[model samples]
Target: MGRWEPNARGRLEQAALELYAERGYEQTPVAEITRRAGLTERTFFRHFADKREVLFAGSGRLAELCAGAVAAAPAAATPMDAAVAALYAAAGVFEERGDLVRLRQSVIDANAELQERELTKLATLSGALAEALRDRGTDDLTARLTAEAAVAVLKVAFEHWIHGSGEQTLRHLLGECVDSLGTAVARGPGAAGSVSG
Candidate 1:
């Protein structure tokens, strides 16, 4: 390989994803990933901590995007509204990647360890969102609740978007999930009380 090559990080990520899909995440080695990318293992380590990091390298940036969006929301916006804004911001990133996001999800779904890591990443994102809400003057309980609910909406919407036909965008699914959440909340305890045990 040339001493200087552009988009090394992108090449590494693409190579890793392809290898993981072809040979399974657990079975794919770092050496193989580097070889596939036409880069040295030193180059791979420069961009990522390990093979798994190839799949998750964007998590930190994603969290920052979400939290920043929540913090930048208008002062008049409700906590949930701010959280939804974060979700929309995240959707933009996923929408841009399109098939790459779907392929990454498939790779993660095929590995139990990757799935656990994905959950951990989502939990961290929820915490960052809660902190942003608190910075907006929301009370702790309200901030935590709103952030958790927003994350749940994101998770559900992402699953729907990944599995559904290509017609519906993630932003649309997120809006629908938000509406469903509102309907469920609007039903209130009385709605549940009406049902016989």
Candidate 2:
């Protein structure tokens, strides 16, 4: 029989992040996390597969959010438009969790393995998004490139948002990043302006 724990998962996550920031991820153990959370190892395993998953719990949710947003975007929307919609969806999911997400990023930034895991998760999201775009009648190659571009845009927007001051939304940051990227590409040599021939 399993013992019921009230808010055990949340407790575990909070404790794990606190310990990770204080002692570093590699130096922390499941036993210590459970102890800090005042829960048992069984309770910890009940909520998470391992310690690493605690920080990445949002990945699955964010992937689902992005794919669903892309699928639900207007049929007449361009690939970039659909991608922007998906980014807005991600912003909605992340907006309320800024502090926790920042801490998770901090922990990941300080660790190579966690950084790899973060990249792997983003790759997974890109593949899922490409599949979603294909379902919206896009060609495979175009869908793939579009999804990859979306990931890049999202990454840049997130970096800017995390490090910036003020009340800027991730959605706004995404739009600005996309606009900047478009401007840079548009102004490249031989792109409608710089024919010094």
Candidate 3:
């Protein structure tokens, strides 16, 4: 096992998020986040690059988890299966923090800069997944397309997860989103007309 401080990083992130909501992301300094977390500013720098990094810390970890999942997927798995596996990897990284995600989402919702950073993070995750799939012998086109679809599913599933009961798992929500996507694709665009009948 490695060094762990009872989730000091988690505490700092949660504190920063709460402060972002109350004080605005720009207004909240690193010192304030550390103070709120009952930690020192030195500890904050140990876990993150800067104040802006608090909202983005998960992106790197999630990308690593996704890439590892894609790399470990069975040789017989299809591109979509590999992509789904990458999405499944998110459960371990995010499932326990539905409330924290909800809070972070609210802050991002109110801040344009954070919204752009979120988009960049999603793109980075997609790129990482695509690269991992390519390493697994997937064609470039299939790998990129599957990775994008999977990342989109992750975003939508995470949106759903943050809105529902905290007890619900991220993996379960991801499965739901995947099923919904499949159903919509099977029904085609014409299915929308049926809603009025």
- What number of backbone clashes does candidate 2 have, counting pairs of residues 3 or more apart or in separate chains? 0
List the pairs of residues colliding in candidate 2: none
lDDT of 1 by residue, 1-197 (tens): 43667999999999999999989999999999989999999888888999888888799899999999998999999999999999999999999999789889999999998999999999999999999999999999999999999999999999999998878999999999999999988866678766966
Best by lDDT: 1
Residue 158 lDDT in model 1? 94
| Residue 27 lDDT in candidate 1 | 93
Q: RMSD of candidate 1 to the true fold?
A: 2.5
Ranking by TM-score: 1, 2, 3
| Prediction 2 global C-alpha lDDT | 0.88
Q: What order do you get sorting by lDDT, best first?
A: 1, 2, 3
Candidate 1 lands at a TM-score of: 0.94
Task: Candidate 3: count the clashes.
Answer: 0
**lDDT (10s digit) by residue, model 2, range 38-151:** 999998998899999998877988899999999999999987789889988898777777777787778888899999999999999999899999999999999998899889
Quote model 3's TM-score. 0.84
Residue 193's C-alpha lDDT in candidate 3? 67
- Maximum-TM-score candidate: 1
Q: Model 3: per-residue lDDT, tens digit, 24-98?
A: 988988989888888887778888989888888788989998999999999999988988988987876675676
